[model samples]
Target: MNETGIPDDPLLLGIDTGGTYTDAVLFCERSGVVAKAKALTTRHDLAEGIAGAVDAVLAKASAPARRIGLVSMSTTLATNALVEGQGGRVALVMIGFSETDLTQAGLRNALRSDPVLFLPGGHDVHGNETPLEMERLEAEIAALAQDVTAFAVCAYFAVRNPAHEIAVRDFIRARTDLPVTMSHELSAQLGGPRRALTTLLNARLIALIDRLVLASDRFLETRGIRAPLMVVRGDGALVSAEFARRRPIETILSGPAASLVGARYLTGLDRAIVSDIGGTTTDIAVLENGQPRIDPQGASVGGHRTMVEALAMRTFGLGGDSEVTIEEGGLSGRIVLGPRRLVPLSLAAHLHGGRIVEALQKQETRPVPSRLNGRFACLSGMPARHATGLSKSEAALYARLGPEPVALDALILSSAQLAPLDRLVARGLVSLIGFTPSDAAHVLGRQTGWDAEAARLGAALFARRRDGAGQQLATDAEAFCERVMARLARRSAEAVLETALCEDGLDGAALAGHELMRRALDGEQSVTRLRVSLDRPVIGLGASAPLHYAGLGALLRGDCVLPEDADVANAIGAVVGRVGVRSEAHIGQPQEGVYRVQVAEELRDFPDEEEALAFAESVLMRDLHDRARQAGADQAELHVTRDIRAVDVDGSRRFLEARVVAQASGRPRMTLNHD
Candidate 1:
């Protein structure tokens, strides 16, 4: 037993992989965080970063790897991929919809150049099916299998009857080794195109997420940590790693959701606003009554609204490593932070040593400042298979690139080559190394441990650029860096206020920039002083939160709480989360005294309403209980909720539709003994 009177033999290990850093934490239920460590995230080989963080934390706590009872992880890889428009190429098979339906739910835009196959087969609201064209699918399946990594199948009204979707999924699985995703398996909602969009995204992310989970599993086995692995879902619930692999789209906001859970656990706050800043994105959400608010409509990421249930998190492309760009055609030379992340010059120098620094120095010596100054590009270390569909120009430029960073000036001779380079970066085959908030932080001494001299040189080169009026942007490098930091804080404040406003059902994007709102945020003092503030305190969670959010309270007119160990909050949340699974059934009346119940892939007819409802509740309860267990829960408890729609006719109640939902929840199972 430890000093806290709690058994110390079994500890919990939590891991969180973000865009830039991978964090690990050791925790005891009674003692809280015991030790935590962070390592630069190695995208090329995630296992390296995972091992580094885990080893460091284990060494810090002086604990044996076998002591860990449970292992849980939350990752931002799926989220970042969707945000940055990078993923494996997959084919979408639309079983019922027409070419026009592709225009719905932004499905066409999401598909990009990927292939889509349409067949005539679907079901109606009454669970009646249209004849499927099997021959068309059979004829093209072989050709489609040649280039695609996976497949997504969506059938019309699949929520009411999934037979067609199931048939398509089974056929694809039997014919190919690749994974297949079905829309009905993901959501019970009735929107066919949106469901298809979600499934396509899940299909695209399967290989990526599978790799991460497999790597973690292998690493844990090697370390002798004989514990069940759990992954955080977007709604702050935990699920088995296997479950997450099948529906990675559900993990779009996994890291942010985990951080919200951790903030509540650490601060014990019943109501607050949580903003977590990572390397690539800032996620803002609200917590009420000690729980994150689930979005009723569904989780929206990268402008694609999905049917996956998740926390109401608003993600912005503003973070420490966000690319810093100058607004074009502006006399003020206003600086803009990203919707894209870049390899910070300071970090690139730290990793590559003298080469990065020497290149920056050389760039600073050039008399004429160019738009490409202080910019470099390197291969992103993705496997060559991902580069299959690249254009000829992109292929040629990619052939010239290597693992090492090369200055943009040396790589591109004319403006025509810039677009190809950008295309390569967008495909995740390449990474851009340039000035970012991290570099600015290094220049201002707000951050350290990186190559600050390189940051200074990059800042100098950027500061010398002429604005629209042909004037230098800043008097000195330090002054320009200070401006960058100020802009970060300002953007952070806007993000927080925007989330709060949206939660209040206001038009956040419009109201957040209104003249009055701007005046209030700026603390304008005139005949009438305007002020804006959040009703609840802001809980800042991130490694860079302390450095960037110091002055946020005054801007928002509310207290900002930076909890202890906030740097590792996501990791902490990963271990403390509970496993939960929910199953739902719907009962509808086609005629008088005839009831139909739809549960998953099964559609049943009942003569009595009570009997239908009872059967649905029973089936859901049983299924959810088993699902909870499979999702890494032990001794789960089940609860049922019913929402019945009816109308009064002649003073008699008439049933329209009834929805039954069963939820199973329990603490994640842990290994009691490791041998």
Candidate 2:
């Protein structure tokens, strides 16, 4: 489709489903971005956020939902389900390997919650194996009916020879008709347990994403939008809803990736670190060659370590809503939110009836005497406080709240069982961490001409904290933010290391060494789909309100453009996605004779060379078609690979071997069920 063919003034929706908020944006096809909005993330029903944001953006644009011709959504639903331990119950059926295989690399931890089921069937690396007992497996399945909501079947060497795995899957389908994930169907990696772990997590995540997509569909319907819906993927590409359901893991980093893509599209630059600080976290991504850097190992969800492909991004918990507590003069008061974010009732101030200095004055009225009672406050260099008269309670509170356990993580994640009083207490802290609407406005630079002082004062009030808290607190806010950033950088580097190099040989000490991660970050040189684009300018989008935008645009230090409707970038992003299908099949020989491999796709051959190659090509195309069909793809375009290897035994003879893997991707409108 021609870009100009789209409506000049039409609204294109982009939606970003983050860990904390679902933001939406409306971009004018003619003038660029037009409007934006956000809604509280509805964990109970994701659609709530989507609908809320969409309506808000529509209102902002003074347009109707029917005016939108395209819609796209980027979600962390699949990824979050895995990470938050909220996926449906799942069964891991290992066809050939035993439970013993799970002992390596803490594999046991990966499969901890999964119900492990062993079947008497498996194949060798070459696909040859002892046949499984159909009757016995059927009986086992019959009994397993009550145990799990989904099934993940991983046959030994299934990718090598999928016949047994296929047969078992067919059997399970015939019996239960449940959602089933096959190892060969998911990836082509070599590790059995790791591969199995990937499949299991995928299957488990299915239960949650199915609902997420359904909710999203319903939300679009409410807006009167009936466009062929697609979801943005982690690779900065797009895929169909049906495809998303089967491989939800791919969407783990969808939100951040979409922003990176938008950034590149806006500035047309690459090779810079994109730092997006939101309400709950700060996402740092490196762009190379106009793309986000994809984590080679793929980030882990919860702890499953699924290969949900995504750009390498560092997520820091320090956000608009982080907890803050100041132990002062032996008196401890938590800001609850964060040193930066200030809502109403900053912890220490909240404890003083929402007044700014109640907690500190209480210390002043105390009978006890301490050295801090007379300490002078220093900005660059000035007297701040004197702790000499701190009371016993206040002093002990200071010692206990001396900083360490940041309160933000706990307040936002309030549990149901916590009493209202406790929740209130937690919320006071959360508000301090969470940015208020005014603070948000200030950060986004929207409040520039209006009232900067008012915004800062409002921030102080909502946060229940005064500027002086920094003087009395153990550490300054800027230093605290830096500390959070450093930790995030370290963690992100470690995740990247595992992907750049295999984790098999790393020892405990090596894993813990910060220097090792630093070295890895410095040495990376290869290019992957997830590239960070620092070459071109980065375009920043979001509703930081007033605070983040000013210093932020400067920090970006490049040609940074904000969408006219930056707040709802997600809604526009949601509408920019597409449906895609991919198929892969490997053909090889493990032993001397019978040379064969698996085939996928609908075409009768290996694409261009198939008719010439005849049988081999035909088989190759079928597997690709098969996978496309399964992925709900209508037609497929193939990008095939043929890997030829020459192997020599240590002592003597050399042999030539060819391993063929064929892949095809296509939109899902034509033969949507080809796979």
The reply for model 2, stretches above 4 Å from the true place, is 1-12, 27-31, 62-67, 134-136, 325-541, 549-573, 577-581, 591-594, 601-637, 647-675
Q: Using alpha carbons, what is the TM-score of model 1?
A: 0.94
Q: Can you write out model 2's per-residue Cα lDDT over 566-667, one digit (the tens) per residue?
A: 455444545543344444445454445434545541112122223323455556677567655655444667666666555669976443345466656654
Per-residue CA lDDT of model 1 for 1-675, tens digit only, reads 744444665799999998899999999887788899999999878889999999999888888787789999998878878877878899898987999999999999999999999999998887889998878889988998999999999999998889998898889989999899999889999999999999999999999899999999999999888888899999999999999999899888899989998999889999999999988989999999899999999998888989999998888889999999999999999999998899999999998888888887888888999899899999999888778778999999999999899999999989999999998988889999999999999999889999999999999998999899999999999999998999999999999999999999999988987899989999878998888888899999999999999999989989999999999999999998899889899888878888999996689999988999999998888788878988999899899999999999999999999999899889999885644
All-Cα superposition RMSD per candidate: 2.6, 11.4
Q: Largest TM-score belongs to which candidate?
A: 1
Give the local distance difference test score of model 1. 0.91
lDDT for 208 in candidate 1 is: 86
TM-score per prediction, in order, is: 0.94, 0.68
Q: Which ten residues in a row have the lowest lDDT in candidate 1?
A: 1-10
